[model samples]
Target chain A: MATRSRALLPISFVVLLFLLLYLGLYLNPRHESDDSPMIGKLAPEFDLPDLIATGDRFSRADLNGQVSLVNVWATWCPSCRAEHDVLMRLAATGEVPIFSINWTDRPDSGGSREAALLWLGRLGNPYQKTGDDGENIAGLEWAVTGAPETFLIDVEGRICNRITGPLNDRPVPNPENRQEVRNNVGNIMKTVRKMVAGEGKCLTQDS
Target chain B: MPYSRFMNGLIELNKGLRMMQKQLIKMVYLLLLLWAPLSAAAPIDSLIFETQLQEDRFKQLVQEIRCVKCQNTNIAGSNADLARDHRMKVYEMMKQGKSDDEIRHWFVVRYGDFVLYRPQIEARTWLLWGLPLLLIPVGAWLLLVQLRRQRVQATEEAPVVGALSESEQKKLDEVLK
Candidate 1:
């Protein structure tokens, strides 16, 4: 009987180990929701004190009136710097007003508010209004995963497009991958122009 | 004869031994149940540490090389899921105790040196590594060219200053005034 119990010991351990391994596989961290975390959602609303003003506040109302582009960026994000020229050109063109929502710019995480301000000053501000989202309250609402994200919103405040990562208006040696970004940006601008022309609803009923 | 008493004592001892064995079996079963959930959560902490390590290594690597994807933005910050997965795979290899050279070699064997966040110091990558050393002279030459061009343009465009006539400037100034 003692020998029989000892024989069962190894078998029990093998069973236990396999169970844990399967559990880990089942618990694998990935998307747990059905939503795209972007499409079919209202743009995140925020009202925060302006970084540049003492008593004044910057809110969603600041984004009201006409279509706009919201660029979420940070000092720590290298791509944000890469897209600086493209944003400057977009602002310079004045085809659409660009707004900036600075995300997670606290100094403790290697992103400093001072650094963000200096970056804008040195690079030239492309944003009509800038809001400091130092704690990332706005980021959570927008489901932002990283920096250098640009969103195109219609005049009625509905998000029409989202471009992840940095924008490069400059030429590249490869043309194949370039089509994706170029096409997305082009479609967004075309839609924005149409919205401004008062041809249709800012958002389709199904959209 | 006291044989009856002896038989009773022997039977009692057997019962106690059986009870001890039953309790031991129960304890074993209990341990198995507890270990299952504990080990499942273990890998999450391990993976989180690996992710942090990957970020540190990525910064160290990208400073030494250009991004293969898009003309701008290094491999470190490209939002392409491929870049993110590559970083994670590097962490996984590191966790498995693979040396940095071995990891770089694995990438070179598959995607070639272009996949390397930092191109290795080899004959094929010699120019890539050598470019920064050669850049100082090249950059100076470019700067000189740009400054000279700017100086020429400034002189040429000086007469075009009337492009902003005083009356228009004064009118805009008056709005501020």
Candidate 2:
């Protein structure tokens, strides 16, 4: 019995060590891409002036009673430019309305409403309404770390999932975006279709 | 004539001295007027505080909160735009009469516990906060067990002190003879 217990100790210790090492490997790269704590919480409220259509306003009220996408974009961010095509395609699908926050388009940040409007005009206006968040007040309230972060809001306006990087159609040529573009539509459309089907669920990490 | 001349010179000197004193006081008042607006005016950032305590709280909060855009740099140390926004956010919340804890909760909710350098003792973080304390007793117990084993071995290996060996006793008896 003594010898048997003694043999079990090192085996258990080795197993525990492997378990810890496994967790370390998984946890190390995750801090920079941590899951949004905003999941399952109500989307932060904002009343922003529209970017192009100057007289119009986009607020939390706009997102109400609809499962839609709130995208954070800035001309300064290159990833946002990359995601633009995907956004246009997504908008064309007419599956859901995409409300955009043209985040931090002030001169200091090297982005302006003109630049945003010009970009949208040249490419295509994919947004339902583009909010000019020049001051970044709404951006700050939304906890936007950087541009090209997209949030999926449920019918009740609770944040279901947040994609930290740009949505892409094909794999982005950049090696850095490999993790972000894993079968793009599978990440979004699968969950979106379910939510539209009245599942009304929030956690999409597994989905 | 000399007395009158001397008295007139003295009077002139006194008048000049009085004028100089008045000018000096006026200059002091002018300087004070310049200083008052600056002292009373809000700082360049307009982060004016009703009390020194609020300013200190703001200072403490920025120091403790991490800038989400940057790795490892606190909001106070970062020059990133997000950091500036967060600083403004801190100022705004403080102005709205939110306490430090409430302000911390605001950030934590938005950015998770990673935002705070000093995390709260919550469900997921209790292990992080409590493990070092828990180890103290565990380590003490292990040391105690090892020490007891060593003591038993020490007693067994140590030479008996109450009596000599038979050969040593014989040698002693012979010496005495």
Q: Specify the highest-DockQ model's number.
A: 2
Model 2 Cα displacement at A42 (Å)? 2.0
Q: What TM-score do all the candidates reach, one by one?
A: 0.43, 0.72
lDDT by residue (B37-67, candidate 2, tens digit) is 6555332356778899888898899989998
- What is each predicted model's overall lDDT from 0 to 1? 0.67, 0.84
> Candidate 2: which stretches are off by over 4 Å?
A1-15, A23-32, A171-178, A199-207, B1-53, B159-177
Error of 1 at A132 (Å): 0.5
DockQ of each: 0.01, 0.59
**Candidate 2 CAPRI category:** medium
Pull out the clashing pairs in model 1. Answer: none
Residue A129 local lDDT, model 1: 78
Model 1 alpha-carbon drift over 4 Å, by segment: A1-35, A171-175, A178-187, A199-207, B1-177
Write candidate 1's Cα lDDT for A50-144 as tens digits. 65556777677766667888899998889899888878877888998898888788865578778888898898999887788887766645645
Error of 1 at A196 (Å): 1.7
Model 2: per-residue lDDT, tens digit, A1-207?
988997897899899999999988887564345577887799988998888777889998898888888999999989888889888888888988898999998898998889999999998989989888999988877888888888889888898877777887663444466545542744577678888886565645455
